[model samples]
Target: MTSWLKAAAFGVGGIAVAGLATLVAFQERLVYVPVLPGLPRAYPVTPSRFEIDYEDVWLRSSDGVRLHAWFLKHSPPVAGPTILFFQENAGNIGHRLDFVRMMMQRLHCNVFMLSYRGYGASDGHPSQPGITIDAQAALDHLSERGDVDTSRIVVFGRSLGGAVGSVLAFNNPDKVSALILENTFTSILDMTGVMLPFLRFFIGGSASNGPKILNFLVRSPWSTVDVVGKIKQPILFLSGLQDELVPPLHMRLLYEKAAEKNTKCLFVGFPDGMHMDTWYSGGDRYWRTVQLFLEQNVPRMIDGKLSSKDEDEDDGRDCLQRL
Candidate 1:
C-alpha cells in the first residue's frame, strides 16, 4: 500500500512539471493571439467599407521585419491632432475599423493604427522586443510623412496595447504629445496571478517580488508600471470598473504611479463598462471626457505658433455610435 501511494504522488508531480514546461515553451501564443478560432489571417474588411478614406501603410521595423498599418486622415488632413492607436491583443487592426470610424467622425482627428509583427499582414512572430520595434517603426513612418501632423500625435492604447504605448511614450517623450490607456494591467507577472490564481504560490506575494522562477520564465514582461512613471507626456486613463479580464485596480495603480511621476494624469472610470465595451457604456460622459482632455492637452498650429483648440464649444453628442 505504501508503494502504490508513492507511485501516485510521483505521477502527479510529473504531470505538474510537464504543465509548467508547456506554459514556458509557448507562453507567447497565450499572450499575443493574433487570430481566434475560425478568424481568417486575411482582413475581413477595409476602411473603404464605411465610406472613410484611408491609406494602407507598409513599414519595416528597425530589425527588418515588415509591418502593416492604416492611416486615416481627418478632412483636409494635418489640420487637427493625429491619434496613434494601439489595439488590444487577440485581433488585427481589421477588427477595429468600426471603432476607428467612430473616433475619426466624432473626435475629428487623423487616425493611425498598426498591426504588430505576426498580426494582420505583418511579418514575423509576436514578442515584446519585436512589437516594441514595430511600434517605433510606425512612429518613424508617420514622422517621414509630410501629410501627418506629427506635432500633435496622441498615443491611444487598450489592454496589451496600453503597455506598448507606455513603453513608446517613455522612450520618445518629444515625439508623443499625449498618452491614453484603457483597461491596462501593471505587469504580465502581476496578471499571471490574476488569471491563474493557483500559480500565485509560484509567483510570490507582491507584484514586484521578482527573480521568482515563474517571473524569469515570462518571455514578454510588458511591465507598464515600470515605464509609466518614466513617461513625461500627458496621460489619460480610461478604466472600465467592470472589466472581467484585467481588473479595474490595475488602471488605478497605473494612474497612481503616473500621477506620482507626471503631474498631468487623469483617470476616468465607468461603473458598468466591461473589458471591451467601455466606450459604449461610458456614453456622452465618455466622449466629452475624451474630447475635453484632447482640447486641453493636444495642441495644433495656429498660423506659426502652437495653440490648443477652444474647449468652450460643447458637442453634446451621446454614445449612439457604438463600436
Candidate 2:
C-alpha cells in the first residue's frame, strides 16, 4: 500500500509540472482570441442604415503589418471631433457597428474602428506590442486626413481596447485630446487573479507568495495602472457595476489612479450593466455623458476660430459640473 501511494503522488506531481509548462508555452493563445477569415454572417448591419458615409481603410503598422479599419465620416461636410475607437478582444470591426453608429449619429462625430492584426481582414498575428502599433497607425491615419480635426481627436477603447488606448494616449499626449475607457482592468495578472483565484496557488508559490509566477509568465502585461498616471488628457471611465467578466472595482481603481494626476476625469457606473452592455443599459444617460465629456475636453471651431482652452490646460471643472 505504501509503494502504491508513492507512485500516485509522483504521477500527480508530474501532471502539475506539465500543466504549468503548457500554460507558459501557450499563454498568448489564452489572451488573444482572433476570429479567422471565412466565418459566416460576420457583418450583421450596413453603414447606410446609420446614414453615415464610410470607407474601408488599410493601415500599415510600424512593424509592417497591415490592419483593416472602417473610417466612418459624418454626413456633414465639416467633420466634428473624430473618435479612434479600439474594440474589445473577441470580435472584428463589424461586430461593433451599432456602437459606432450611435457615436456618429448621436455624438455627431466621425468614427474610426480598427481591427487588430489577425482579426477580420487584417494581416499578421496579434500581440501586446502588435496591437499597440496598430492603434498608433490608426491614430496616424486620422491625423493625416484632411477632413478630420486632429486637434479634437479622442481615443475611445473598450475592455482590452482600454489598455491600448491608455497606452496610446500616454505615449502621444500632444496628439490625442481625450480618452474614454469602458470596462477595463488594471492589468492582465491582476485580472487573472480576480477571475480565477484558485489558479494563483498553482501559478505562484502559495497564497502568501501571491501571483508573482503568473505575472512573470504573462507576456502581455497591458498594465493600465502604470500608464494612466502618465496620461495628461481628460479621461472618462465607464464602468458596469454588475460586470461579470471584469469586476467594477478595476474601473474604480483606475479612476482613483487617474484622478491622482489632477487630470480631468469622470466615472459613470451602471447598476445593472454587464461587460459590454453599459451603453445600452445607460441608454440616453450614456449618450449624454459621452456628449458632455466631449464638449468639456475636445475643442470646437466656432466661427472658424478655436474655442475653449488648450486640452492639457483645462482643469476639468466641466466634468465636475456634470457630475
Which predicted model would earn the best TM-score? Answer: 1
Please list the residue runs of candidate 1 whose C-alpha ends up more than 4 Å from where it truly belongs after superposition: 1-15, 76-78, 204-211, 306-323
Candidate 2 least-lDDT 10 residues: 202-211
Candidate 1 residue 277 Cα shift, in angstroms, is 0.9
How far out, in Å, is residue 16 in model 2?
4.9
Q: What is the alpha-carbon lDDT for the whole of candidate 1?
A: 0.84
TM-score of each: 0.90, 0.86
| Clashes within 3 Å, all models in order | 0, 0
Judged by whole-model lDDT over C-alpha atoms, candidate 2 comes out at 0.81
